[model samples]
Target: MVFTPPQNYNEIKSLLENLEAYINSPEFHEIDSLIKMPIIHYQFESIHPFYDGNGRTGRIINMLYLVQQKLLDIPVLYLSSYIIKNKNDYYRLLQEVRTKDAWEEWIIWMLKGVEITALETIKVVNKIKILMDDYKKEIRSEFSFYSHDLINILFKHPYTKIDFLQKELGVHRNTASSYLNALAKHGLLNKVKIGKSNYYINQKLFNTLTKR
Candidate 1:
């Protein structure tokens, strides 16, 4: 979605340009903040900047804006997952914003998602931290230094390919493979082939990420 854009659209370039101008302004979000997050969110969605992936991109922007405003310390708020569940209402409200300029209702919906998503993310972060602590305190030291680093990196990216590790950790590709392989040996990871790429997932991290 991020890479594949929609067909030619007049609003796409204008939206990106507006977003660039907004994010770049030193005092930009001050007024946005005063109106509260919902208006800002409605505005983002209403702007509908990209030719494709506008919904996903707008959700990403929402999360980033929360972090930028210090409303969140992490980007774990999966607001889109909720919006996906209410896709009909999401689209309906967006349409209302477009047709009727119904700012209040749109903003309310966004703020509600913020509150709900914030609570949900807190629960997730707490569980992940607990899992992280357990792993840090109890994992055997015999797994090697690479294994330790790989486990930690998995907390950031639950499943990763060798390229991500090589670039992020400044390790050789084989070294990254060795690290992931060690985790697989320890029964901490399951190796999976995705398309042409092989990815390793720390089982513990996946459990936290995919928990009910």
Candidate 2:
């Protein structure tokens, strides 16, 4: 389907000025940041300042605002999944606000997205923590020589390379390869070849992330 942006090209700068004035105003800060977040997001999206990447920039601003307002210790909770899940509703609500000045509905929808996404993110974090604990126990039992830091680095991403292990552990390439191979043997990682390079994939963590 074709996309309809919230603002006309000529209106971008003035809309952004309005956005800036609102954000910098005492009234904006008087409200609870969480209460203000949806309003800010809607305004930013409606402004549509950039020629491209407005959606992405708007999403980043959401996390940054949380951090700036000290609403979150970390800028981790994301609304992308929520927006993607309710793709049609997301666009429709924005359009409603533009066409019919349906501000209440749009605001409520955004607030709901934030609440739902926060809960889902918390669940994902807890699951990852549990998986990390299990990995520590299994690794310690299987390989007494394995470093906890090494295990952590693997969890940092779904796939890791020998070079990463080598750099982190400050060991030779062969040693890193051997460690990865041992993990693969214990079903901790799956070995995969891409072109001429070998990589160790953290299947459990990968599956957990990709599950939803």
Candidate 3:
């Protein structure tokens, strides 16, 4: 495989220097991190320091920077989906900066992307909360001896094994297997065997998380 970057050695070196200066400079913290994220993103993509995955790495940094700056409580926002949906404009705005020095439009585009992605993230989170509540109610009503901790563990991970449930509930392997099998019978989980171990998959939570 061949890999290419937009910048040469000297250009990349200069870009790195600028990046360090920006990180330590007052302007980075003087403005809100959310407001500064777009400029930082543009610089990173323009530098294109990596042979591959520059965009992916820069996007990850965007989310990390938000957390680092305490702008977000969690890095759950799905910024890439918005960018993927508007793939053309995303690149075009970046190019506008390189060609015409259009900082305003590029920044605005990124800000809008953040806003839209944030709202989408909120909606997904609320949906998951509703699902979790429904699952709790159904589990409580369906099972006379249901463990709330078991429910927490299930939602924490969409996939669970006999060993996992056994450890979480401090029950024997047979008991754990029985619980998973019961859920499968109730249509709340699907049982699948991988090698020697069996896993119970939470279909509804998986669907909600992977919806978009």
Candidate 4:
């Protein structure tokens, strides 16, 4: 019983119509198509189409649709991170689209965010993978075993905290801290002081993040 956008989105069932019709159509190259994804995303959020996780759901749909249309090879284009960084402007831009006919500005901002996000994500992913490979070749894990999921999480959140890993991997605090410290001791993570907490973000990953 998932909702689906109808034929004429602006007319009836606009939220569902806009999303379903656009995805079902072969209109990926058009500017309208490109703009439609985010527009529908904004409208979906504004309409509060779902009762729970509406914002996150809409955002996930945005990335999924982009890759569905073959515009992105991977779901690495995360505008949410960018929007999260500039929350005020994010809402304002979307509001302008709903209020005025300022398609140009909205599209411009959306496209720019897409380009910046895609390239930035690409850089980070590549760098993180490279560093992970270096770890495998240089420092082998001690006795017993470890999970390969570590590399995946490291790629997702380069600055992963011990507490976070403990929760994720279902390990004790000391074990989590040890894993993090191991990564750092082996010259993988660079301990950074962000305000109060000491973060063990991968330095090689940070290099990618900070590199233009």
Candidate 3 lDDT at 103 equals 89
Q: CA lDDT of each candidate?
A: 0.71, 0.84, 0.84, 0.71
Q: Please provide, for model 3 over 31-115, each residue's C-alpha lDDT reduced to its tens digit, 9 standing for 90 to 100.
A: 7677688989888887888878988888998998888787888887647888888998988888777778998998888899999
Show the lowest summed lDDT stretch of 10 residues, model 2: 1-10
Residue pairs with clashing backbones, model 2: none
In terms of TM-score, the best-performing candidate is: 3
lDDT tens digits, residue span 89-183, model 1: 88788778767888778777877777787788788788889987766654555554635665577777777788988988889999888877876
TM-scores for all candidates?
0.70, 0.87, 0.88, 0.59
Candidate 3 yields a Cα-based lDDT of 0.84
Query: Which runs of model 3 end up more than 4 angstroms from their true locations?
Result: 1-14
Residue-by-residue lDDT tens digits, candidate 4, 13-92: 66566657656766644655577676767667666655478778877888888888787787767677777777877778
In candidate 2, which residue ranges exceed 4 Å CA deviation? 1-11, 25-27
Candidate 3 has its poorest 10 consecutive residues by lDDT at 1-10
RMSD of 1: 5.4
Cα RMSD (angstroms) for every candidate in the order listed:
5.4, 2.6, 3.0, 8.0
**lDDT of each residue in 1-212, candidate 2, tens digit only:** 34455566557777787888877688767877777777888888766677789787888888988888888888887888888889899888887877889888888898898889888888888999999999888888889666788878889999999999889989999988898999999899999999999989999899888776
Question: Model 4, which residues run further than 4 Å from truth?
Answer: 1-14, 26-33, 140-212
Q: What 10-residue stretch in candidate 4 is worst by lDDT?
A: 1-10
